[model samples]
Target: MNKILSILAVGMVGACSAVSAADIIGTVTYKGAAPAEKTITPILDDPTCGASYNGKAPTTHFYAVGANGEFGDVIVSLKDTTGSTGASAAPAVMDQKACLYTPTILTVQTGQKLIVKNSDPVLHNVHLNPTVAENEKANEASINAAQMPNGADLNYSFVKPEKFLKFQCDVHPWMFAWVTIVDSPYYSQTGADGKFVIKNVPPGKYTIVANHRKAGEKTQDIEVKDASVTINFTFEPK
Candidate 1:
């Protein structure tokens, strides 16, 4: 009887240890001189969506850096994480307003839903061109569809992992965005303050990778025990 009680106690302790979880929080900074800003002609004279910008050529948001070198729109994700328990049922959105794609960088998990919205009062076509690998010729995917003025949203999902899916509005010619489809929920994008937090990470060793649309990428390996782990990454231009 005592032996059986001891076995049950051991099992309970093991289960408790297996349930350990932690948070990964960090800030991503840019080193050296901030990247140069890029801009495209909004063609405000176009008698269509261009009017939404109020006859102003807006600066491109491809690489946004603060006065202190804070980097925005950097994707921080864990490598080799596989599972589907943390994804939310709520859909991710990419809004089109003023001839631009809001939150120019979007990240979503495999099988997750994405809603693309057009907020302007002009016709715009959302074109998605995914870089196809040599072996994926038969699986190449593309989306070239128009959204009417104040039109219905475009709902989409990708079944496989893709690093960068370029988005553009062929109608506007100046509209651009990118979507990243990941398999794990352990991912985040740095905000205008260059800060990000990834919570509820299972205790384990992981290689965390950070990527910016233009500043390039950096990686760091870390081991998370029962408590939170803080890691920061810096990216510099070549």
Candidate 2:
């Protein structure tokens, strides 16, 4: 009888431990009028790349603001977390379609695989330019590789954390993408609706940071206890 009671108490403790883990959810908003994006006329002028877009040209996506003020492309992450098992994490993918890189801004955990795919019919190059000194060794030495139309995917991973590591195509000077690498899995990117969620965060105090490529960053101290927490961030035009 005593053994049965002990087993039941242990099972109850495990269940409570599982329930203690919570999530962090929030939304990011822009405060001021968003800047107008300029049309990349050169993209439409090119013979090979321009054909992919038919006749219409696409403008830059510097600001993905919605009807209200919800902002997108902002990276929200927790500070001081490290030792990510990103190697086992699902791969993050970036694709080039219609002469442009989709999801111009992306975030991934350190050591996570990044697969770059060429979906366009024309040849394109993947060029990664990482500026951080600590990340130089982890980055690709050649930095530039060409990919034929419908070519095999290009795979990459970074050992260190770096923010806004740029990837560009020299063939299309206007083609660009930014990838931010975090040291842990506790990170989320705001969508077009400006909403984000970081899941399974243990009960603790942390410093959360929300960063925008053009608008800078904001940070706040938070404590996650029994239930999920909500923390919102706002940015203004610089």
Candidate 3:
């Protein structure tokens, strides 16, 4: 009996240790000379496109912001999450302020959640298209503005293997958002100032991806073991 108890205790310790306590953090920025400021088009889905909105859903795209020819609202993620748990970090934000999707590129992991906050008083619909208008990977992931009268927060979990996901406000029709679900917890989004930090990572071989959303994405492999890893990546206009 004592032997069995000892074995169980060790098992529990092993399981606890496997918990990926590491963190990945970073910022998204433009390459080369930042382009002339130009307003992006709203990402609303056209009714004539025959997509399903059900009258209570949002399916439009927000105006897109592009610099260095790379548009905001792009997503990047790890292809495999087999032995990995979802990321451990504050939910990356996709704020709708001034009718624009802030930080068009967002990083997320499997089993993680996204909090949608309405910073503006105007009514807006939060619509999502995982595969976008052309691929149509799936349909109808929505948070209607009318449903949340005041400020609102919504958490979304990604359970499948997808390359990318897109979001928009049907009401405003000019609001747009993007998300990438990585299999591993080791990922980060570049901030406006163009910096990122990944923390507590287990020492091993890993890859880092720079998310440009519409401008496309770039990836780099890294080796780490004991302490934190610091790496920087830049993408030329695509």
Indicate which candidate wins on lDDT: 2
Higher-scoring candidate on TM-score, 1 or 2: 2
Query: 91-183, model 1: which lDDT tens digit per residue?
Result: 889998877899789888776778899998878898887774431342233278789988999877776677778888998777888988777
Q: Which portions of model 1 show Cα errors greater than 4 Å? A: 1-18, 48-50, 85-88, 132-142
lDDT of each: 0.79, 0.90, 0.54
- Tens digits of lDDT, candidate 2, 1-238: 5999999988886788666878999999998899999898899888988997788888999999999999999999999888686899999999999899987999988889889999988899989988876665665543698999999889888878888999999899999999999998899999999999988888899999999998888999999976789999999887
Better of 2 and 3 by TM-score: 2
Mark the 10 consecutive residues where model 1 has the least summed lDDT.
133-142
My TM-score estimates for the predictions, one after another, are: 0.85, 0.90, 0.61
Taking every candidate in turn, the Cα RMSD to the unseen true structure, in Å, is: 5.5, 4.6, 11.2
In model 3, state the lDDT of residue 89: 51
On TM-score, the candidate that comes out on top is: 2
Clashes of 3: 27
